[model samples]
Target: MRKELYVYHEGKPVQAVIRTYTERDFDGLIEVQRVSFPPPFPEELWWSKEQLTEHVVRFPEGALCAEVNGVLIGSMTGLIVSDEAVEEAHSWSAITDDGYIRNHDSTGHTLYVVDICVVPEFRKTGIGKWLMQTMYETVVQLKLNRLLGGGRMPGYHLHAGEATPEEYLERVLRGEWNDPVISFLLRCGRVPVGISEQYLEDEQSLNYAVLMEWRNPFNSSSL
Candidate 1:
């Protein structure tokens, strides 16, 4: 809700202060992302604190970060898109598979989760779940309709060109998927809707990825 809020687990008490991302937090966010991801995205792609501030000045509350002891440990980035925009993106073959494109026109709002990362040491301590709960609270407060992202097989290992979609699905269905991060999201609320075959193919890195959706439970009227 605010920077003053603290999430407690065990006796240690994790003081997670969430706020809108600023230029000053970019470097710290980048560091957190690098440590949290296996093949971290390039740091250069993130805008400087100044640029981010400018960007947020126009689109306020677009990005958020969680910090403990003044150090950023996790962050979530998302964008508000229209149903038309979603349809347009789906129209492109290289973007996503048709099975993954749900009918969002009936939905009121669409908040696409671009990224959500937490440092390894702080995970499984209830911090990740707290952060997600906080996100749901924030989304409801902001009147957003849904939360969406991609789920990966946690801790999954790729053996060169030997990987296959069927093997990945089998692993996930069998509950052998190893990626802790993705598993954490799944446990929190994200549901597997479809496979992100294009993303996996373009990256040439992972064997499987799934599109996930987390609808706003507060929307009683829609339900």
Candidate 2:
């Protein structure tokens, strides 16, 4: 196991280890997505096996998985993109481009985290934090300036009929409300940069997302 990426869940050491994905982990990736993310977002929202396989081929290092007892329990998928790309509004499918990931620009200075899923059983075990920290480490390794993503506001579903995203965010920041995705990102030190409408088909986020960023505070170049 990689001590650098160790984690704990539910009063026990998380019997999982994080690593870049390999060809064999594809099925586990699908299973994690299905089991971790609950319904109503439409099955189309999930990554197809072909798409995930191609992504692993294109940017192996950007696709990470947490294996527990040899079963894949978590996944974090990302694509390298230019700073300009992230500045624009993008849907999950648009950024991923039907799983082709056509926008993985080598010259880009940002890593766009397209998806991060952990099985329901593994939720709240610090697994998400470990995955995010690993993402930070990846940015430094790749010499990128930051990590950028359009993250779901899972708590928005309940308030979408009454609250504007702006109002909702205010509540989240005030601690008057709690959003699983937003709160997790907050724990990872990611800052909300903007509001993106129609970001994903997720009912939880009301099809909206928050543009977030985590700048590398310890890039090797700085040292």
lDDT per prediction? 0.59, 0.80
> Across residues 147-197, which tens digit of lDDT does each residue of candidate 1 receive?
666665534455324546556655655677644545676788877666654
List where candidate 1 sits over 4 angstroms from the true fold: 1-11, 37-41, 45-51, 87-108, 154-167, 170-176, 200-207
| lDDT by residue (tens digit), candidate 2, 1-223 | 1433456767777567888887787777877777775575466666677878778788877888887778888888888987677667778778767556866888988888978888888888888888888888888888888888887888898998889998999899899999988988998899998999988766678789888898887775422
Candidate with maximal lDDT: 2
User: What is candidate 2's local distance difference test score?
Assistant: 0.80
**Which residue pairs collide, candidate 1?**
23-49, 154-178, 154-179, 155-178, 155-179
